[model samples]
Target: MKRESKLEFRLTYDDSKEIEAIVCIIPGGAEDMNSYIYIDDYLTRNYKVAVININYHCIGNRPHLGSSFYLDDIDKFILDTSLKAINLKCINVYDINSYENLNNTFIKIDQEIQKLKLNQQLHQNYKLKTHVSFLPFKNEYQN
Candidate 1:
C-alpha cells in the first residue's frame, strides 16, 4: 500500500503462480474493503489472479478513511501500463454473490430446459428476463 497516494488497497496474490491479471474489488456505497474478503479469497484461489480490495471514497466518516483523505480517491492512482489481463473487472465489485446466485439459477433453468426439450431461444429469453428483474431487487434485500 502506498501512503503518499490518496488511493489505498489490500493486495492478495499467489506468488507461486505467474499472475497476469488483477481483480480490483470495489466496496459498496457504505461498505469498506473488509466487506469483500470472501470475494478476494475466492477470486485469487480460483482464478489465479491478483486481488486488490480497494478502499475507495465513502459518503460518511470511516476508520480507514475510505482509501484516503481526498474525495476523488480512485482517479489519483495510476495503473501500470505494462499490465495484461483477459479483462479488467472493475465497478460494482460489491455484489459478486448476486452474480453467483444468478448463475446457479441459470444452471437449474438450463437443466430444466434440456429435460423438457425446450427451445434454446426461449431459454435465453427467460434468462434475460430473470436477470433484468433480479437486478432491481439485489440491493433492496441487502443489509
Candidate 2:
C-alpha cells in the first residue's frame, strides 16, 4: 500500500466509517491497459469501502493477457496479509464485475468480514449460533 511499493492498489473510504477489511480486486484482463484508476474510483465512490485494484503486468505490452497462474500468487498474498477470519466461511465469494450486483455484493462482504473480525477482537467467545465449527475454541458446543 506504500507509494513506492510494487503493491499497486488504489484505496478509498468514507470519513465516517472505519476500515473493517480490504477487498482485493484481481481484475480480469480483457485488454492490456492500466484501467484501474476508473475502476478504483467507481467502486470506492459508490461502496464507501476501502477498495483496492491490484495491478499486474503482462509479459509484453499486451492488454489483459496475464495468466491466472501468476495472478494467483498476488491474490494469495493479499488474502494472507489483509484479511482476518475465525473460519473460512467469513470470506465473501462474489463476481467482481457484475454491475447489477456489485454494490450489494461489496456491502455484504464488508459486513460479513467485519463480523468475523469483531468476533475475533471481542476475545472470540464464539457460540453455536454463529455456526463456525472449525476453530479449536474450548467453548465450542455440540448439539
Winning candidate number (TM-score): 1
Clashes of 2: 4
TM-score of 1: 0.37
**Which runs of model 1 end up more than 4 angstroms from their true locations?**
1-6, 59-143
Question: What is the lDDT for 8 in model 2?
Answer: 47
lDDT, residue 95, candidate 1: 32
Across residues 1-143, which tens digit of lDDT does each residue of candidate 2 receive?
Answer: 21222344555566676666667776555432256667666666676568766553322223234222121234434443444443445444323333334346446655766676676743454432221112111212222
Per-residue CA lDDT of candidate 1, range 120-140, in tens?
423344431221222211112
Poorest lDDT segment (10 consecutive residues) of candidate 1: 77-86
Worst 10 residues of 2 by lDDT: 131-140
Each candidate structure's TM-score, on Cα atoms with residue i matched to residue i, is 0.37, 0.30
